[model samples]
Target: MESDKMIKPTVSYHLFLYREELARRNARQLRLSRTKIDITEELISRTVKNIKTCSMDDLKAVNRELVFKRKLRNRVSKLRKEAKLAKQ
Candidate 1:
């Protein structure tokens, strides 16, 4: 009777941790998926077409912003890769 009580509580505690970790992993994946849509090849080409046809200053501003943003993204990606290598 005593071992049964101890084992049941321990198992329940581990199950609780497992559920918490699964929830966290799912939330992180959801957030990353949203980021993927904003920076795609299709979005780039569409932007270029808009810049050609668009006279609005705001649209042109967005095009220039994406240009510099891509450069920054490249540097950040390289740094992240270097950090990952250092960790291993």
Candidate 2:
């Protein structure tokens, strides 16, 4: 009877710990999901703004504009890569 009493409290303690740990993990996942959603929204907003601003002129001009944007994006990506490497 004494061992049974001791085992019951031990099991209850472990169950409580397990519940707490699961709750913590769930909260962390929720925060990460929210962050990803926020980033996605920001990217969409920026893309929409760029599309709205792009002029639809002559084909040559449009091509030139696209090339320029591509070059600029490549440069930015290179810079980001360099910065990340430096941090490492």
TM-scores for candidates 1 onward, in order: 0.35, 0.35
TM-score of 2: 0.35
- Write down the worst ten-residue block by lDDT for model 1: 29-38
State the C-alpha lDDT per candidate. Answer: 0.54, 0.50
Off by over 4 Å in 1: 1-41
lDDT of 1 by residue, 11-33 (tens): 33545544565578454332333
Cα misplacement distance, residue 41 of candidate 2 (Å): 17
Q: What is the per-residue lDDT of model 2 for residues 1-88, given as tens digits with 9 covering 90 to 100?
A: 8886665334335455545656783543333333333343444444456775655653445455456555555665666677689799
Q: Which residue pairs collide in model 1, if any?
A: none
Candidate 2 global lDDT: 0.50
